[model samples]
Target: MAATEHLLRQGSFPAFFGIVAIATLVIRYLYPDLFSQSPISKLPYVGTHVGLPIQKKISFMTNARKLLRDGYRKFHIYRTETALGQCVFLSRDSMVELLKKPDEVINFEKVVIKDFECKLTKLASSEPIVPHTIRSDLTPGLVRIIPRVAIEVARTIDNELPATDSWTAHNIYDKLLRIVAISAGSAFLGPESCHSEEWIQSAVGYTIDVVTGAVILKLFPSFLRPLAAKFVPAIKRVDRHRAGISRMMVPIIRERKEKANTPGYEKPDDMLQWMLDKAPEYGIENDEEMAYVQLGVGLVSIHSTTSTATQALYDLAARPEYFQPLRDEIAKALQESGGDFTKDSLYSCKLLDSFMKESQRMSPISMVIGKRILEEDVQLSNGVFLPKGTLVASPAEAVGNDPAHFENPDEFDGYRFYRLRQKGGLQGNLNQMVTANKQNLAFGYGKHACPGRFFAVAEIKLIVAHILLNYDIELADKSVGRYPNKFHGDACTPDTSKQLLFRKRLSGQSEI
Candidate 1:
């Protein structure tokens, strides 16, 4: 009995358990897709020395472009395995077919919901309500929305930017972010709540928290997200932001609902009211749900607009020569419209539009727009078989930089597309940034393309018009063109910390 007790106390049981555990982990790490028969299962992997797990992390962090380009060169549609699962890379030509499939076949919401673990985080839902609200009211009502957008742009620029005739250096991305938050909040949440400093803070927090959470959650495999989600600080912050937003919005919604119950009460035609109108049917009526849905709209409108504007400003600052030409155009447009922003006035600045387009073309936010996870086994137009759970994205930068599409694709010719517009041909409309097609996927292409693009265009142009008309801006380092976007695997965003110097326009320079 004494001898048996000594043997047990030596930790033989623990040793056996530990060995089994280690063996299980090794197999799991080595063969993440062992159960799947997808082409990804058989494809030659990236790195053998460091193993698949460590190699994927290093290459993705250090040189994603080289890794991506190497794979793209070898196979037009090749697969790479990661801790997060296999992601398939396709060339520009595959986009036409990839986009043609219905939502049922190639589900986008599922991908977002899966990658971001939206179900666990509840930061952004996979519902059709936001899209429906956008398609039905927001885009169609751009002309009406433009005035609201312009007013907010004017107010925000004045309030957020430094005052007259003095040069002040600022983080342009941060400035644009705050400006977009205020303006987007005004457009999205309505006038009363948008002005509340607390609400603006929460709104901005929501965008940061949700995106950061999504990115962090995506670092793990799909199955591990739920368990890993709790450890991610950003994911937890999303819940806190949601709670804050609810405190602000609950009363407004309750009052709106109560008022609608009153006889002859007219409901406001704002985004909140729109969501409320769809609530009962969509089953997203709670204050928390309402706040999240609207924040999702913020997700679409704020960052994209702010990022594009920031980089565009950087581009303009880098080339200060465009400042006068652009200002002159805005001055003429303002005078033509009697010192007001209208549809005709905004679009009339063709050069300004072209500049914005070129900046976006040069600095796109992602390598693939409208990326999706395959819900079922599917075949592409090129006869490649993509199995269920396959991740795919069509080429964005490749198409934008292709010489076959644009003249001097590598150069930043502010007036290149505008010149093409002046010569107005069948492809001239394609030159416009908002015109989404096979070639230009900045706003995406096909039925699922962004619905809020019209509002984005008007809002961006108005803000730029206001700035160009009021201030003289310059790059901090005129020698360096602009800072490269921060890249994370397939994602890209402007470095928000980059600063710029802006001074008020000299007195007597008001052409309007």
Candidate 2:
């Protein structure tokens, strides 16, 4: 009678309800087919299913690489549940199969926009003006862009890095990210605004805010997300950045519009002009909307470019053996182009290209690329049925490291692609860092593959070339190998906290 009284006292009515609530969630997680009504319940998920949602999410976030490899090895197609919901992972061989499907069947933009939580964050709605402008105007205008971007890159490098022959500790990721943002600002925002500290802050802050806000908002229940978005610091900061961008861009957009058709007016050569030129057909009616579109574009470009460049630098520093050859390639390219880093000159640095590609293969931006949300239920050629509203992706990282795709894939052979290029013909064409084949998904694949990849490759090459030409870099802690990568979910990024030792090259070729 005394023991029963103690048990009853410990398990009060409130505690009982709490226990019951947790038990229900656990049961739902464990026996999804019976307890959950979601369509994706039937799909096989990565990791153990007999845990609470938070535990599964934690595993997904922290151990994505291991889970991805295990899933890729065991099943042809499977799902992984995270804060983003259940994302179905397809084998690397599914690239060709996915390529056969039109955007109508497997939508790309929808997944991106959803992941960004554009509705709550007010980051950007669907805007064709961004990609359309990038594809049509910005790409063909690389002749103009390469020179302008190079100028900012040179200037930013000089400004951000200390001029010293002695080794100096620097947070290379922050320096590199800042350099990328400021330099990309020139091509994306224009020369007038690129130097503005306000624009740079807004551009960089907005990308971070969108990501932070989305992650935060995902933590709340769907019904409470709207309220949470209003109060969330990052979500609120996103609006501030959006408003500032509008204030900065409206007058410029208006001026561009007014001068657009004037007889003697030569349009400004930048992404803003390109977007404004193509806005009407894409239904971009207001100046503010155009500014948001620019933010959206910056969001896509800056982070990936920064991460790619950072990883390549880390790799170069860790394996300092590649430095002399890369420097030689840069020097040769510069000499051939009369010391200007043009599109052709940058592309001609095939060794640097190979190095960056190798770096990317070893550490891609994400374990899985070609992420898409299904528009309608579809079956793969191998007869894997995917339901509508299911998220899907290809295991590009696994493919990059696969022996069948790359010989001795685990080894960081910087000259791998460069040597492959010497083989000539179709193999050489596909080996280019910008070219996205089944084996190379750094820029993804199919019609929806990164439109900015050509520019991205150029930008990465330009930055790396400048660094090689200007500075000798290595891990700040001389004893360390490549700084460890920070993984969150499927995303793999170079560690920003680790510092690198940068010493100005005393006798290097002139800056690009």
Candidate 3:
């Protein structure tokens, strides 16, 4: 009461309210939720959170997996500091209940906005149009573009890799990145744009730049980030790429618009065309907005597909015994589909699908899944309460490796899912690369599960099928098996620096 009287005597009511308003804004920026009001604050915290907040944040940034694993072991639900803010990590049992909640209560887009700094980077809007394009058009159009995707993948491989009888070591990650960029680009930007070096670089560069810029901007104080973003090299590069992409895209968009009603006009079946068709419905008005959406699509698709494909390749090379079987399966599937690599042929290659799924299972993308930021209060089935503004996720990596769910989970069984599929029940449907369930959260789970995954999985299969049919791959260092994945915080990515030896096969396997 004395302190309250002292504060009142210090300034006018307007001044006091102004100071309180500024403090409220600052606290909201620093903390994801109100420390005194949030239910998460009542839960056990994984790391120190009271004092030394910066140190806690640094520890969380560097040792996220360790902290997460510790939290998973110790608590049913726990709070942990992140680079962004505090997040609540849930146990495996609670994931189903959390995932079942509607977007209005536990929102996915809100989490993405906070995590990706979408508003600052100008990479995405709260309600993005790309997901609609991917689900409604891109995935459906795969049947028409499988042949084109095959051609692009083949061309990229031939151009980037040597077709020599003798083994040549190459950075397989870089090679696959290029292959995915061009192939995925063909769908996102059309064939002509994919051919341009400037566009490909911009597409690839934008993803890198945005990530780099986000990381750099995150290091600054929230109030200073706007100023920091203006001077950061990576942030500047992102703008250049964005402007260049808009310049290149505007003309093509205009041309397509002009030719829309021509008597003999044939609209291209690609993401750009599909996106343009859906843009108006999503409040995307100008060419610049269209370009941003296209780049946003590229950002998610290219890097993820490339990393998954690279990981699969590393696994295939490490365990060479699976190669011939995958090759034979691809050959059989292609022959069954009348000598063309179509949707049917890709789907028919069950062993390949299993192998990809297993590769993903062993080295899943991130440690957590079903990331959400609650917009309204949520109560899990277990009666755990999450207040509005709470960030939440499940321990995905632990769940994937749990022996209770997977038999001999530690062993990297390439045919794990294939054998499950052979059981001829619900397991068959659940064990695919693209299936995102409680068990498989590599692509996340529920309504927010990656919409572009079907196309991504198809592209990955196509690239791997082509590689198996045309080349022999092995680790450059014969003693080293699969290169270990590199981790930064909760994220896991293929070792980009590792090289794999590739040589052309003695006899050309038929084109997949």
Model 2: how far residue 304 lies from native, Å: 1.2
Per residue, candidate 2 scores C-alpha lDDT tens digits across 1-512 of 56545657887667666766997876776766577666556666778566666777778888888888878767757778765776888887776687568889888777766777878988655667777788898899999789889988988988999768799999988888789888988998788787776787788889999999998887777888999888899988988898988888888889888988899999888998877877778887988888778788878888889989999988989998888888888888888999888999988888899889999999999888888888888877877777888888877777687777788988889999999998999878889999977768778776767899999889888888888888888888757678878888889989888888888886754444
| TM-score of each model, in listed order | 0.88, 0.91, 0.90
| Candidate 3 lDDT for residue 367 | 80
Error of 3 at 102 (Å): 2.0
Put down candidate 3 lDDT per residue, 4-30, tens digits, no spaces: 566789866676777789978777656
lDDT at position 42, candidate 1? 61
lDDT against true structure, model 1: 0.76
TM-score of 3: 0.90
Which is better, 1 or 3, measured by TM-score? 3
Q: Regarding TM-score, does 2 or 3 come out ahead? A: 2
Mark the regions of model 2 whose C-alpha exceeds 4 Å error after superposition: 1-29, 34-44, 508-512
Q: What is the lDDT of candidate 2?
A: 0.82
> In order, what lDDT does every prediction score?
0.76, 0.82, 0.82
Per-residue lDDT tens digits for candidate 1, residues 1-512, read 56546656896777666766897778767677665455666654443323567566656655665566566556656666433455776767786677888888787876676556677677554658887888898777776777777888898898888655778888888888788887877767786677776677777777777777777776667788889888989888887877787787888888888998899998786777887998898987577678767667777778888888887888887888898899889888888888878777887889999999999888887655667888888777777778887877665765677677777888999998788889877657777778888767888887878887877888889888888878888876556577767877666678777788878787635568
